[model samples]
Target: MDEKENSTEVFFDILIKNEVVMETAPLDEQKEYILPDDDYDFHAYRILLLIRKCGIINEPFFSHFTIYGRGKFSFFDFLIRYPFYLKRVIEIEKKPKLLDNLKLRSFETERALSPMIKYIRGPWDHRYDGIFNYMVSKGLIKVEFTNFNKSKKAMCLTLTELGIQISEQIIKEEPIWVDRMDIINAIFPKNATNERIDDYIRKHFPSLMLGIEGE
Candidate 1:
């Protein structure tokens, strides 16, 4: 298949996998179009990949990664992964009898997942991002609004039944997902723009990007 067909296929694959795309009556020619760009697809790829990678499918219905933008998340990560704070939280959550000890205030809801983030990247020295906060802006997941704590207080959270179900589905299915960014970014390089992205499509998928010309 050609580039146009291939990319459309990929989009449908995502829609089908998530059960978002369903057959509907055909639309007019003008409506049957999508802007051409590697990063356009990359954005979707990153969001889905990050959600799956973070094992959010297994966490509370209010997964922070799903809710907030990269900036907000960076702030939360700063607090949770700070060497001193992360160490303390992980020790509490990682205990063999964590569920049993949930009664104590120390076992507050954030305890369920925040510590795992700490264990992954300790010492509180990681890069910052705003994408995660954007996720929040998109209303993709449940998240606590305030990011910073002058006193560095941890927030409380809980797992709704839906979260618990999703968690189980992830564990049981272990679905295979290819990070489309691997392909998307590879085509566009690390730094590319809408114009550049459009040019590529015009070059490779002529009919798709309105034909390559002033590249």
Candidate 2:
């Protein structure tokens, strides 16, 4: 983390950059992101979208997200939204494939760290752990592992080109504030669960995967 880039204020500025990009997007794509009375896609549309919009460029992206790191609140949520808004986001995935066990990384034990610090607070935990094992299983993400180490080892991660493309195409449509409102309305509506939130989300955001009603 760069000293000048990790502060909370820097984080908001990072968001401001995307917000600027968002302003350049076609107005037609800026429909209100209301939720449905029912289902949604929290992964493809949401996760990918967060990364695209929130580009993995700086530490600010996680400045706010680390707050929810103790829980599985999906930091990827705020990062991926507008695929067209970010150019560099698609660039990060251009690295070589991660040959599982081929590379390694070691994290210093931080008993002083909070629970949020241990986990990335997003879906990367599994990817980092199994070397995209499950992703390889699904054929969504692939990797080969070589060389093993146990005592005080280093764990290196290699993200593939497909991973970058996947990140771009899987982004969600809802912005942070919008999605939050949609979720709040869904889980805690004026009358406790309004169907309009569901209807609106479905109409404008047909690609979402996570259900908010029970959340």
Candidate 3:
């Protein structure tokens, strides 16, 4: 393994061993057992910390950029909800046949393009694994598996306290991206169903709904 992978593995070993003991230990002992500063890949560490604070939950879809935006316009939300999709659109633009193959037409606005592109792309991107794995290894987030039956399983991601704290600090220091709130909010409104989200996107961002039936 490379340095970062090796370091992260060592960190996970320490974290898993200490998790139970730390829960029952004295406050000072708990603090002492926390991941050491020197052991972290600082860039990845900071990214996860920032993401947590921004209220963008990392849902671990097939793509690295598939995080959900919740509660407001934060940098993490912008990264996942906008720039990531924009990059995908750019890729599509470079190859018009891609849109044609998917039975989609390019839209002039992001509102129209975002959802359709995401649907067509199907969230398979794995570029964010480095940061994700680092966060997992450091115990800032966890991976859980649910076995539904003899042949099915589902994986879920949830944050830990340390992850929340770091993300909060990132928010406190960075300026909010106010303009993108409507789009972000539409993508993940409070308790909305997939059907509702689809309806809302189609109604408000018509460009995204183009070439799809039942609009």
TM-score of each: 0.22, 0.22, 0.36
Ten-residue stretch with the least lDDT total in model 1: 119-128
TM-score of 3: 0.36
lDDT tens digits, residues 1-215, model 2?
Answer: 77766797687898887775533557787666633211123332333333233322223322111111111122223222222211122223332231121121132121211111122222222322342354444444323232112321111122235545665454343333334333322332222111343443344333332432221
Q: What is the model-wide C-alpha lDDT for candidate 2?
A: 0.30
TM-score of 2: 0.22
Model 1 TM-score is: 0.22
Off-target runs (Cα >4 Å) in candidate 1 are: 1-31, 36-45, 55-139, 147-215
lDDT of each: 0.34, 0.30, 0.41
How many clashing residue pairs, candidate 3?
6
Provide the global lDDT of candidate 1 against the true structure: 0.34
Report the backbone clash tally of model 1: 15
Flag clash pairs in model 3: 49-166, 49-167, 53-167, 53-168, 112-207, 112-208
The residue-by-residue lDDT of candidate 3 on 181-206, one tens digit each, is 22333335422333444444455433
**Tens-digit per-residue lDDT, 49-142, candidate 1:** 4343332221333333332323222323332222233333334335433223223234432343222222121212221124334444544334
